[model samples]
Target: MLLHIDSSADTTADSVTRQLTEAFARTWHTAHGNSADHRHRDLSAAPVPPITPAYTTLGRRVEREGFVPPAKVPALTESAAEQREWGLTLPYITELLAADTLLLGVPMYNFAVPATLKAWIDRVTFPGALTDPDTGESLLRHTRVIAVMARGGGYGPGTPREHFDFQTPYLKAYFGSLGVPPENLHLVAAELTRVDVLPQLAGLEELAADSLARARATLTALAAA
Candidate 1:
């Protein structure tokens, strides 16, 4: 089963990562047909709320009223943000656990992953609630994640501004700690996204197109696998 998630806030044509994920979803359907089950989440439209301070301040009970049957003990009267935060986090983890693979469409925002995507990660992986305090074993460890990313500039190894990019490495650590293996966490990234829109990057248009083509080809292989 595949959980297809799109976090792009830009319009369809303007969002390169969304376009890449569309290719992935289309290729998967063509390859597997009805044999594979699919679920989708558009994070931009229904954004996941940010993790509240109470997420860590409180005891290991964020998933209580969020996932399990038991209700909030004292009923979070401290703050409305705290109460609402718990209500949304567990569902993210629940959806994440329902799939064998995750196809995420994310755009680089200020050199990092989109805020909407970061919010989802922070909430779903709350300490104590979603992870074992000691062993850190999580159901998410069994799932594979394929990230379709779009960046405005190049940040490959040894690039001039390579150190400026934090999205890829942050994702590796974020999902890695959750049990998504480094090998299983795949990235299909198209850099130089501003090439077609900004005059300063006009020369990189061909490179951007090549990256998109490569992303599609990689998705095809992943679908077949």
Candidate 2:
């Protein structure tokens, strides 16, 4: 399935990342037709488990044995124990492994990605789950990813504030560490700035459009292949 994971926390109806993601998905579906299965997850609306101590412990066990440990015996008036018991559900490792493509909608927050998106990455990046334990090879066999990003300021290469843009570099390193090739990591960025900088902003938009067109073409070829 083509899993579309939107991590933008913007509740506003006119979210740029959401709009771009929807457009990308629509184009992808139109090209692939019934050959592709669609699945969507909104991390902002339904927050997944953050990486807590209990979460880490449960995740480790699941990674080793592919099963969560059984619940312990309950004690009298142990409401806290009930909460621990609920945490024993098996992690969604299998669903992640089964995905063919992952379309991520990531927005820059304080020069980085949202914590919710990082949490999702933590869940999927198990030691032996998505990587080789002995050789340190990535188990993310699927090679396609489309990351749609947006920022409030212009930060492309050669721009004065480009050094401040850590979103692309961080995401590239993170996903590259997981075996996604540099060529497979496509980004579409939109810059929001002051009205006085509209001309420069238009240039950025043109660059983004050109990149998007190239990405769509590459994806079409990949789908055909």
Candidate 3:
């Protein structure tokens, strides 16, 4: 199963990451045909609310007491608010757990991931939910993540602004902690995405176009693979 997620605030033609992800999805679907199941989640559309105190409390309980089955949530939940939060969060966890391939369209927002996506991350990353508590093994070890990232400025190695790119590294670290090996995580990033609209970046339009083309090609190839 493939879980395609888009976090770009702009769900329009202007979003380079969205274009890349769309290309990826199309290629993937064409390659897999009816044999594959594809599920899409637009984080910006049906936004995942940020973690609440009640949610954290429930998460803490899970951490302290270990995993609990959904059928027993009523017995485990201490309050209505926690129950509601669990109701909201459980689907995200289940969706992720069922996915063999996670396709993420992530646009760099102020050099980091959008708060909407982070909220989803926070909700689903229960202590024992995505991992094996007793053995410290990650349940997502076999899953593959293809992150198509877009940045407004250049952040490649040796670039002056490279140090400012906090998006990809954070994703790598977060997924790594969740038990996804480096090889299972594929990153296809397009930089200088603002060149077409930003006056100062107009001179780098060629570079931006090249980057975007490369990113699109990579996404298609990865999807086909």
Error of 3 at 148 (Å): 0.6
Task: List model 3 lDDT by residue over 1-225, tens digit each.
Answer: 999999999988888888888889889989999567999999999999888999888877877776554545557789999999988888998999999999998999988999888988998886578875567678899999999999989999898888998988899999998989999999899999888778978789889989988998888889999
Q: How many backbone clashes does every candidate have? A: 1, 0, 0
Residue 150 C-alpha lDDT in model 2:
73
Q: Judging by TM-score against the true structure, name the best candidate.
A: 3
| RMSD (Å) of each candidate, 1 decimal | 3.8, 5.5, 1.6
Prediction 1 global C-alpha lDDT: 0.76
| C-alpha TM-scores of all predictions | 0.83, 0.72, 0.94
By TM-score, is 1 or 2 better? Answer: 1
Q: State the displacement of the C-alpha of residue 125, model 3, in Å, after optimal TM-score superposition.
A: 0.8
What tens digits encode model 1's per-residue C-alpha lDDT throughout 89-201?
65776677678889999898998988888878777665444454456466667788999888888888888989988888888888787677788899878888788778877
Per-residue CA lDDT of model 2 for 1-225, tens digit only, reads 777888888857566678777777777788778667888889899776755565555445545554222222121113553345233322445556667778888888999999989877775564355654556565564557778877766686798898998888898888887788777777667666222356656546656556546545544454444
Deviation in angstroms for 111 in model 2? 0.7
Clashes of 1: 1
Error of 1 at 112 (Å): 0.4
TM-score of 2: 0.72
**RMSD of model 2, in Å?**
5.5
